[model samples]
Target: MTINLTEYGLKQTIQKTITATEQPRLGRVIEQHRELYQLITATGQRQAQVTGKLAHQATSATAFPAVGDWVLFSAGDDYTTLIDRILPRQSVLARGAVNQHDGQIIATNIDTIFICMSLNADFNVRRVERYLTIAWDSGAMPVLVLTKADVCTDRADKLRALADVTVGVPTVMCSAETGEGLEDLQPYLTAGQTVAFVGSSGVGKSTLINRLLGATVLATKTIRQDDDKGRHTTTSRQLLPLPSGACVIDTPGMRELQIFVGDLQQTFAEITALAADCKFNDCTHTSEPGCAVQAAVADGRVSLERLQSYQKLQREMSYQGLNSRQLEQAKIQRMFGGKQAMKRVKQRYHRD
Candidate 1:
């Protein structure tokens, strides 16, 4: 069965690059295991593995093919495929890997991202801010989805509290059981658009996807009754196409969400705008007499907690940026050292 590439969000730029060659076939990666992939091609879905050259040339995990990536490959007679190269992506959503200073790719070529948080015990404004920072950096629109609304009693109060932190971003209160607030998401679910559902495990991400899919296509688990914490259900990422012509990618619940890189000022626009009004050009907003941000906190215009979250994310980004630069410098030094050693060997040979 031939599939329409445009329905999977293929753009003219990529369409123009497609060649009428038989050896290399074009397809979109719909599933990814540790080292294997499942691609949806014009012919049909096929299991694929990257070519040795691609694996050898990859410097990091991000260079490899991820779910939602378009790749070129060659098909084998035994129902296997060999991927050659990945096409350029229009947008990608990623976060910092746990216990590492490297970026972890979550989904690529995404148009929208649903940052899920349960109204139950899993809700945290600070965590939502963290997700927002990474989402903004991903070049995709972020929508906050507050799930399990039926269980929460203080819905209005919680929404009021989130209003201060979720500035400019849309928030949808949804209940998979009751089917409330799901229609509000229609604007983002237009045909040809791809959206990803991401949040910590047990936040009802899979449940919401099941509701949207109108089927129990993804596995889901209940949270512990005592602490209200969730267990891992969806172990890998998979892209599913809906009858509405939109695509949804469901990912495993993340235990930790570290920022890889993002536009800090954009995420905290309110704080940045206040800083612009400070009397000093370089006010740090930390006890400075002319700090407008501090003044706002003093007058109850901005919450101290929000300002602190902004500062904390700013520090993390700065530290990571410095580490990345240092890593590059060390790599360059190693390369130059090898050249110097080879030059010394030549000099010794001439002298002898």
Candidate 2:
């Protein structure tokens, strides 16, 4: 039952950790079902649960091992394994937890993220932008995948709409039914690479993964004819290997994607660049005079819709439980000299 660890993206860094540790064996988490986990090692797949010490040390859900995390474990007596430690993640995709200030880990150690959206009734440019922000901040490349292209009549228009927001990010039009644009994803699906598919329900993430795996490994449900919304078929995160030697993590559909810790500047680069030319250092861009962002909107360089989207995401990030004082100080430091920046931030807080 032993399998090659290389197919699961075992690298020198993980090997070093394994070599350094003596008591625990190395394994990669393949599936997560609440507190239960399924890990794959050189021996084979085994059911696992985190050790009591590991659980007690976790302050939040994000601190626990996620589907793509590599961990140290020990064999238990009854065909179970005890996960002792989680190795450092190379990259992580996380988002703000629902109604909570803490972050939720979507997948860890992912090399690439596929932000899938159906070109039908489920398509939304703003949601895609939110996914891109988290993906960019995750230290992984984000590739936009437009699914159900066979049903969409206005593919060109939809691509045009995504052009300004997506910018340099690559977009691939795919149809699981017709196998279109599946081959274009091969470059990112190379052997030993891990990719996670994320989007709302009915976006065909499971279907796309099935097509890539060349088997119906993940369950999928039909979309409702009225709203085009599909039921949640994949209830939990699971990493499955493809015939191509790459691994794909299929996640449950996220209905609402709140901002976690991500770089707004990177997500909205066009607006960030424009802000540099603003008349005031702290121009809010709403009604500020000499606002480069507004000017661009007026001059047709930046769309009003895009600017509004940027402003909305900025507001979301601002209130996502990150230290407000630190955020202000960082902004001031970016605008003024160090000491003067701290002084200005204090004065601004005092004024408010």
Candidate 3:
């Protein structure tokens, strides 16, 4: 008798690389430990594991398969067969690795990125600009989803601000409660297509997904009145198959986003384009004789905050070297930048 992988939800499915172990096995990554990953095979759903060699070879997070990635792997009855290779990705959503100076894969093979933001205190055009740069660098199309439109006093004003920041990207305003503008999402979420949501918490990610699903597969929560930030409701990354023959991956809210140094230029296309007009080949846009970038900023063509954010990310990534010591320092700084004064006081007391 022949076994069919589809029956077991193990057929042609998108899965993330979890881990690779060599002591007891010799295969690569087939499943991930990210908890939110679901694997499909020719037979049915399968638990994924990896071989040790790939684990040893992974120098960065991007080297591993992220959510929305399709990989080929063998299967055993108990654990999944070791992964042999990661299939080609159509699109990827990545951010700078936390503490490490490398690029981390947020999700892979994404066809579209839903840039969600709330209409309340959570809205920040600077943040949207930062995200757009990374999204443009990721080789994926970005779609801005402004949620909580019902709460906003003037929806048009809020959307116009977002439109100004995102330039060429398509922006949509939707209220999960009223299902307003939900139909606008259908063009991208067609059958066999994959879409991923990238935004901070309290942006109505789960609420929107629940609306898209026509049911409540994902949980939703209310944000605190003071902070206007979601309660980090979606803790892990998980992909769900929508009834409309599309797939969606929802991830946890990120507080701070760092950009990979190598991709900064690609992400900031406007700056790079403007730099071409610079008189000097290596214009820093500060005090250069013919700095087109600075000229644009001066002329109000480019926002000063946007350029500064780009430069800030570049410097942060540059300082975060690949070495272990640099990585440790970056981690500590990221986790404790706000409490450095108190930290120093405590350290001095302990030493005394």
Candidate 4:
């Protein structure tokens, strides 16, 4: 029953200086299935649900108890616990369609995100770029893990295809079945670290995680030859402890999300940097005479595909044709790119 919360990434700062709360229990959410939650507390794993008050006050799905979220709860009965508060998250992965105000939270407080895509037909560099945008924006380090190494031919060409979008990102190629090249993932799974694996359905996220866990805790379906995508096997988000003393949160097959403006800027940092050198501040990279991004594309510094991907994301999020309210949101993201940046802004405001 008794478990070490520290082993599950209970931050030292929260354990030390946080003031007392009305809630008597502290727990980490390890699994969630729609309305139901399974948590790890000092006593044991408890089935929990959020109080109506908590749900009422929650402005968005991002505020709810997601896998990897820490919550304060109290026993509602022998069978259930009532979650009162979801602790502040250091990092969060959220997704939604274009123009959505309250995007869905995928996971929270994660240290790293393993964006998996099969090296076979399921691999798409643009999709990787989209995942990278969300991962970079989530305040977690993004690592590209290419699964199904055994099935891949023309590996060099595939790797080359990924080069532009995956610049400065850690990438490892391995076959989940053969266990080849998984060793490269060990350095990220050190004690106390929490990594989240995310990709579309049947990209071998479960297979890869099962191999890492040394057991088949999660079910994996064979990849469909017709679509070349994995079957939708993982339905709920669950955090499992790795044998290496780290934890990993595996999510279900994900849909492509509308890009976050801040994430887009980070994901295409090279293009953003190039844009800064443009003679005209508002130069669109398309056919603009003074656009440095286009110049880079022309001169081989930036791949045209990467630029097109960036532009497409911009269009998806309405950044290119932003209205007044959307423009304000863009400004906010530029000012507060992440939580750390937001904190700095607040500190400066107080000082002023």
For residues 304-344, write the lDDT of model 3, one tens digit per residue: 88788767766765443356575444443322222453365
| Residue-level lDDT tens digits of model 1 in 253-304 | 9877777766667778889899999999778789778889999999999999
* Residue pairs in candidate 4 whose N, alpha carbon or C atoms collide under 3 angstroms: 202-230
TM-score of each candidate structure, all chains considered together: 0.86, 0.88, 0.77, 0.87
Off by over 4 Å in 4: 20-24, 77-79, 97-100, 260-262, 318-352
Provide the lDDT at 267 for model 2. Answer: 76
Angstrom error at residue 141, model 1:
0.7
Worst 10 residues of 3 by lDDT: 22-31
Candidate 3 lDDT for residue 295: 90
Candidate 4 local distance difference test against the native: 0.80
TM-score of 4: 0.87
Q: What is the C-alpha lDDT of each candidate?
A: 0.82, 0.83, 0.67, 0.80
Model 2 Cα lDDT, one tens digit per residue, 257-313 = 888666677878999999999999889899989999999999999988888988888
